[model samples]
Target: MNAPTASHHLLPQVQARDVPKALLDALQARFGAQFSAAMAVREQHGRDESAFDIPPPAAVVFAQNTQDVSDAVKLAAQYLVPVIPFGVGSSLEGHLLAVQGGISLDVSRMDAVLSINAEDLTVTVQPGVTRKALNEAVKSSGLFFPIDPGADATIGGMSATRASGTNAVRYGTMRENVLALEVVTASGEVIRTGTRAKKSSAGYDLTRLLVGSEGTLGVMTEITVKLYPLPEAVMAATCSFPTLADAVNTTIQIIQMGVPIARCELLDENTIRMVNAHSKLSLPESSMLLFEFHGSPDGVKEQVAVVQEIAGEHGAAAFAWAETPEERTRLWTARHNAYFAGVQSRPGCKAITTDACVPISHLADALLDSVTEAQEAGLPYFMVGHVGDGNFHMGYLIDPTKPEERELAETLNHQLVERALKLGGTCTGEHGVGLHKQGFLVEETGNGAVEMMRTIKRALDPHNILNPGKIFSL
Candidate 1:
């Protein structure tokens, strides 16, 4: 891998004045109805799941295939317009924002499960297919795709964000599962990286370089992901602890013992209260750990016994097990809806979530200290995590209309990032450095690394047309 030398250059920024009538005329002539002036509806494709509302794109192109993307990119390049690729629009860090007002290239129309190679246990999919949709398609095949981000986010966006979820502890993140990618480079050239050989010492590892690039380097048109066989026997259980530390300690023990646990999640007392109120489930108002075990019948039984003993040692109470499939589904549904529940607890409040990951041994201490800080500041927050992987989310409810409240929340969010860095963790665990964490990224990676990233960005996108003002500033 060759790293470019840092050179200072003034990158061009797109504005309303830069809208080329020639480009629009060309787009209309080429795409007909697929390209229209109505695409100038910046509100539709500009912002994402972030708290800040950025400037939207000057146009939105509904691409149906790789050729469509290439055409759009070529036209944008000719007009010097920034192009931003959009997926399900569920990005938490404003990855979809078209700040410079160019084109928002939407690929949802290209969604399709292209092929399923059952023999090799891999699947090829168009970028627009969501994780839930893929799982539904593969359900009957007795296989499953496990990179879940709690949102039914598009595979393209998931790969771009390097997303992970509850099952990541056992299955791994997009970085681990994505075997290959068919990408459209900044120059509108199509290329494929990686193969289905299961392992390789391939040059440069372009698959990974683009996986978390957040559309800065290229546009992902298709993804090849590794799949896993569905577990034969599964068991899920919930245990309440006298304190958050107790619950986290038990989770630490379970992981250290290598219990083969599929998912181990922690919900602080505040989060549990919110879940009970919103989901209408009667759960004890104490910190809880939701766990799932997967393996053969005997293996699951043995693992469950070991986990139970560890929980008992940590003084875990209300150790209820959900053995049936229906019960397990309901339990997980409740857990997945926890973020929504947290917001519903406050009728007029919007959620601003902050995620950070650390070493497993430090997770409990980090979580406990975070809760204490939030309480001392008199902020309303809920906590939940995929504990086995040491990733968690803190949901803060804020009055968006109040500037003071928003500023306070921002301060707390920055503090959280600083704390994570201090504890030797990335500013973000799953979410990429879209627009939210660029400052923290500078702090985390420092000037030298960021300079290297900028050099790569300039090398791949000299015209600054691909996702301008994201990950790195011009």
Candidate 2:
């Protein structure tokens, strides 16, 4: 959640050259109207959902195909200008920002569902295909893509950030769902890694390397990701707890017992109140757990019974079940809108989100202490998370004009990351180390491992033109 400070000057600018007029003219001629140098368009492409100050790109390229992406990158390579891949600009971190001032490669126009192998339970999509679109496209096949990051983000952006969401507890994150990727390297060379096969012992696993690279190593043009068969019977439930510890403990027990919960989300009383006002729903304004169970009817009932017993032990209230699809949608939709609800609760305020993931065994300690710390600091914050996977976010809403408020939020984030690291977790569970977590990345991985990453970056992008000043510095 911290903004960029002065210490992030480790990497040298690529040749220290401006995006030349010649390069912009060449791109405009090659792509015609798809290329734009208008300040408004450039400004729109530069900023994302992050709270960072806007750093606009020199130009914008609306790439419609892999060839278009290659051409843009090829041209940028020639001019030694950085190429930042843009996908919906829904990212919470500064992944899409043109920090070094170059080209914003907009891939949203390349939206397409290339292939769907229902029998194989795999689908190939262009970079611009959003998660909801993919799920809707495959609905007839009785299968769905499960990695819903709640923002309706593009598949390419999801794959780039290694996104996970409420369903990640059971279906897994992008790292597990993505099978292969067709990438455009820094030199504009198109390459394919991995295949549709379920398993591969082929080579160095470049698919993973590029998956969470955040477009630093290359640009992901196409993705083949695993899919899941829709559950025969689905049931959603909400239960309130006496405190955050009680709710987290209930989740810990459910996961530890090997229950296959499809989605398990944690929301605090503050978030619950905001959701009630924003979504027009009435629910208890207490620490609550929302859960969804998948499988046959009997399986779901058994899972619910077991979870009910677990919750009862923690002094949880009676379960509120949603048996119908419409009812389930209403329940989950409220959960997804937690961010907007929180933002609207406080006028003229922005949320500085924190993503801290720890092991299941450590969830209770990690969450309870964090909530206590935030309360002690007197910061207006709300809590939500995919707790079934030991990942959660704390949205610290602060006025942009208040420097002290931003500083407090950043301090709280720093403490939370330190706590997660000490508990054998990561600085970022799903969000990559985009400008926000570079310092934490070092604390978590140590300098030697970071240097190894730098080595890879240099070998792959010697010119430092592909999304420079992200993850780590050279």
Best by lDDT: 2
Cα lDDT tens digits, model 1, 43-80, are: 77877767766666777788899999998998888888
State in Å the error of residue 417, model 2: 0.5
> What TM-scores do the predictions have?
0.94, 0.97
lDDT of 1 at 410: 67
Every model's Cα RMSD, please? 4.5, 2.3
lDDT of 2 by residue, 1-474 (tens): 344343331233434349899999999999999999999999999888778875599999999999999999999999889999999999887888877889999999989999999999999999999999999999999999999889999999999999999999999999999999999999999999999999999889999999899999999999999999999999999999998889999999999999999999999988899999999999999999999999999999999999999999999999999999999999999999999998999999988887989999998878888888899999888889899999999889999999889878888888888889899999888877887788888889999999999999999999999999888767
- Candidate 2 TM-score over all chains jointly: 0.97
C-alpha local distance difference test of each model = 0.84, 0.90
Off by over 4 Å in 2: 1-17
Candidate 2, pairs of clashing residues: none
> What lDDT does candidate 2 reach at residue 217?
95
